[model samples]
Target: MSSSSVVAFTLGASFASIASAVVFFLRARRQVQKVRGSPDQVVEVQPPHPTWTAGQKQPNPFGHSRTVSFRSTDVVGGSCYPLVISAYIPRPIALVSTISKNGVVNMAPFSYSGAMSHDPPIIAFSVCRKPGGMKKDTLDNIEENGEMVIHIMSEWFVNAANLTCSNFPPEQDEMKTAGLTPIPSVSVLPPRCEESAVQMECKLHSKQDIKNAAGKVTATLILAEVVMWHIHEDVYDDNSGQGPTTVKHDNLHVISRLGGNTYGTTTYVYDLPRPDRPKTGRKV
Candidate 1:
């Protein structure tokens, strides 16, 4: 074909592909709307494999098509952030509270946080810079004082926890604005949230700056050590006899972050025990 004809054909194909994607997206959205349940509707727990053996096959083994991969270097942070968060799924939220040098209180929710070690009790969380490369109050406060109180947000106060994420001034007290009561911490200067069932008084263990390909500092990863734990009696289970006590999942009502502005609950759950390999074939 001629160069002009080839160009015309390519443009036509591109437009057709774009149109198809738009139509498919609209149809999928409509299906989601149709399948959504009411707020008061009870969610049923269904076992993924009710009575399957060790080597049993799962349903729809090849239901999905070929996977598509995106190079991180090719996309901006705005495009990659959502894709990573969505794929990670059900991230635990850290409702971190800190106090400025001037005694100003700040509370914010971070989904990029989790426990790393049990012996030393280390919890690590990442704080991304605000728009225009400005540092977040949480990072600044922790760096200044090396102290903070991390709270596990529950379903009852998730809205309040989310409210703390607003870009309020450092002088503003986010706890009062969110209607969450803050009690004094035992080991840290930052107060603990009274509404949260699990509160950990932590001190800054260390920090690492995360840089992009351009060598610009984009986020700060804060590693904290839990010095003291404040757990509500309702959620504390002492079934371990002498060892460390565990939290009652049903009573805690822990809320986790999903993609976008979505929050998930531990409403539907199942237990799967780990299997041990046969001793006869074990390596020496």
Candidate 2:
């Protein structure tokens, strides 16, 4: 489309969305007024999103600049926190690291982990270092050994997952500190969680390093090949009878970090489906 057409289309969409929002607000005014308004007045408010700074590699608002990937300093400084919450506002995925009985160790939860390939079966998560600091144990164990098990934290395990974030010595296990059971896995030395409903045992594939403001290593992009998967049968779908895939909402509410001690969770959700619109441009 031409520039003028593009601008027109964008403005049209914006106005249409605003109109729809206003209609919904009017319809729900009665309900909203009950909790947040005077007996005769209605109130409407929109929650804030974590906005992006220039470092997140996001498209320039003016369409003139390049993308910028967010760094720890960006998150710490709140310049890119809106983007952190923005990225996680969708389905929140949990990152769990496990170590073996001998001496291996792992690190904390990062929401950026997910499956990339199904044929060879791969999983990925970006492990961030202290802005100018060394690699965390999660990446350390992956380099030393060749395997790890990333577990998903359902609502039940969200508290346990948060417990893993404490500042512990490299020798101390987050599992012990969190009071979770470390169950053995079939293909990896690192044990899986006895509590987690879903677990993927994987071997290292590749590492892509991210740079900090000082040109030092900021994060390591870790990709692993899924060798095995463990799931709790009871919570899974009857057809699959393997994992927690059947959980819709009540069983799988989530909590995630913001910048510091502050965090958020999806205690409630609402659906607003598309409305049917009357056709235009008729001869009549």
Clashes of each: 0, 9
| Pairs in steric clash, model 2 | 50-82, 50-83, 51-82, 55-68, 55-69, 56-68, 57-67, 57-68, 57-69
What is the per-residue lDDT of model 1 for residues 240-275, given as tens digits with 9 covering 90 to 100? 575457788877778899999899876544445456
TM-score of each model, in listed order = 0.76, 0.62
> In model 2, which regions exceed 4 Å deviation?
1-17, 24-88, 100-107, 238-250, 254-284
Candidate 2, residue 232: CA error in Å? 1.2
Candidate 1 lDDT score relative to the true structure: 0.82
**Per-residue lDDT tens digits of candidate 2, residues 68-88?**
543444243223545565656
Query: What local lDDT score does residue 73 receive in model 2, on the 0 to 100 scale?
Result: 46
